[model samples]
Target: MANIFALITGLIFGFGLALSGMTHPEKVLGFLDVAGQWDTSLLFVLCGAVGVTVVSFRFITKLKAPVFAPIFRLPESNAIDKPLLIGSALFGTGWGISGYCPGPAVALLASPNWELWVFLPAMLLGYVLHWYLFKPQAQKSAAAAPENTKAEPPTCG
Candidate 1:
């Protein structure tokens, strides 16, 4: 089942994050610190991830559907809009300040310390705020989706 595969993949990813020192906020902070005592280990980790993605993406694209799912859920939009730019800036700022991106933050939750507690709540608050701002627009799009599917005839009048 898709759920089982997702769980298994999530576990593996969490374990990998833990092993890669990503679970440690200090390590990530050090990586972000360019002029200070900068750590370059995370760069290698990122490169490794990119390498894997480059190879895997080729194979994944060839597949009609995922192994566990009927269809592969891919991003619908590719445009670099204002919201995307703002979101990326916000994410980068938060990551720079707390050194806890979403993936490592989730992994750190398993053995949560004070920092994790604070960061998680703030992270969740950001998500809630985003939903509050964007959910209405998303719902409107969904409501109009059926209309888009039904093609209208040429208007000559």
Candidate 2:
């Protein structure tokens, strides 16, 4: 049931991206392009996302735990480090070049484009490398997860 809900959620998210012009590389690029016709519409989209997240987190914090999972998968780390900086830079560079973030990349895959083919393989390779190379060290040095994290109490109306 949870798996089915996840799939349905993903479908809705993908459809929303596609419908909002976010799945198009050109639209994203235009928003990123500062000089030659900068578009501001994506700003609204981003603001909407951030606003929703902030609002949702408020409600989520009131809950003892998640509905579907043992615990809500919230980030435990509060400190920013070198990897965070480097990863953000890499992600920004790639997004600037390809105009495709992970969400839009997956959403665009449904459109029958070769870009998805190439990007998906590259992304999988990155994941594989991260697992093989960094996963062990990360696991070893990992500190306690966030204090607020816990198993979900049953669903409530």
Q: Against the unseen true structure, what C-alpha lDDT does each candidate score?
A: 0.82, 0.77
Q: Candidate 2's residue-wise lDDT over 101-154, tens digit each?
A: 888877776785888899878977876887689866655444343444234221
Q: Model 1, 4-46: lDDT tens per residue?
A: 8889999999998998888888899999999999899989888
Q: Per-candidate TM vs. native?
A: 0.90, 0.83
Model 1 clash count equals: 0
For model 1, give the 10-residue run with minimal summed lDDT: 148-157
Top lDDT hit: 1
Which residue pairs show collisions in model 2?
none
Give the number of the best model, judged by TM-score.
Answer: 1
- Give candidate 1 misplaced runs (Cα > 4 Å): 146-157
Error of 2 at 109 (Å): 2.0
